[model samples]
Target: MMQRRTLAAGVAAFSALWLAAPLATAAVETPDALVKRLSADILETIKADPELRNGNIARISQVVDNTVMPHVNFRRMTSAAVGPQWRQATPAQRERLQQEFKLMLIRTYAGALKQVSDQRVVVKPLRAAPEDKDVLVRTEVHGKGEPVQLDFRLENTDGKGWKIYNLNVLGVWMVETYRTQFAQELNKGGIDGLINALASRTIAADAKTAKSAQP
Candidate 1:
């Protein structure tokens, strides 16, 4: 299993990438175009904004929650990451899980967003038919190091358009990696155990932020 810190870093990089990809409602907007637009725009925005590149966690997370969450199917992501335990979760339990998981991810990635530099995202070709409800949009983040592969699996929900549910970073699916971690907790305790683990992580992350902001 991937270590929690490694997974957190990888997912944070993904969060920065996807924050660039809000859904475009234009009639001519294809997944490719949408990604292209967001990637370029987000890069430009970051390049011009010192706050985002300077480790401002509150502003970074605000940008993510306000601009990126709308294009994400986080409920689907949280449920899928929980695997079969999702079906067994009570509605309230599921909500708490999603809330805690979202908090953990956003905060973890908030610091990572400062690492965004001259990296450029290149969207790969789309292989899906026009009528396809689901699609995989591949891309690579090229910077100083070898290009890191970052891809998104998006589903065209009824009226929501294309919303991301999964991400592949360096060939590892985000949800799958978390699924293994979550499964371990589930096996040791149960759904509540898993939820508690997520909650604890979020709280710890918040505490770290609180400490950093202290004198």
Candidate 2:
């Protein structure tokens, strides 16, 4: 269980790097090219920014809200993570769930903003044809440790271009991993319970951040 959590954390840390990208690019680059460009741009930005490297939550949160959240398909991610209960959720409940899930990821991003270092991403050649709506961009993160396999699942929107909805790190799919963990909580206390549980986690993380900022 600890190993699983550790892997998940590592995934979150890397995911934060991509989430730091600018909301949109002027050119509609291929998915592989997009990932490669953002990986280098975001890492270099973090490396140069002292505040971001120091884990300044406000700064990190700003980057996430402006850059990360816009590119991510949060509603889809939240619905996938909640599994079957997602369809059952009322519109208000669905919105609440999305907010809570986004909050959790933003907090995770704050903790992980500093994790980007000399890591380099190498995107494998994309195999999809032009008409394909769904595609996978595969890559490996090579740096201070053994290379970690990272892959992204992006769906092309009608006009918005490719939007990231799922990511895999070291073979674990982010949504599936969360779904399994969320299922346990849902079975015990339902959607509200799950929301409350996520809220509690965000609250705890906030306290930890506040304490760390002290002298």
Best by TM-score: 2
- Candidate number with greatest lDDT: 2
- Score candidate 2 by lDDT: 0.77
Candidate 2 clash figure, as a count: 0
Tens-digit per-residue lDDT, 23-108, candidate 1: 44656467777766777787777768787766576776678778887778899999999999899999999999988888777776
TM-scores of the models, in the given order?
0.85, 0.88
The segments of candidate 2 whose C-alpha lies over 4 angstroms from its true place after superposition are: 1-13, 23-27
> Which digits, one per residue and each the tens of the lDDT, describe model 2 over residues 69-105?
6666778889999999988888988888888887787
lDDT of 1: 0.77
Residue 175 error, candidate 1, Å: 0.3
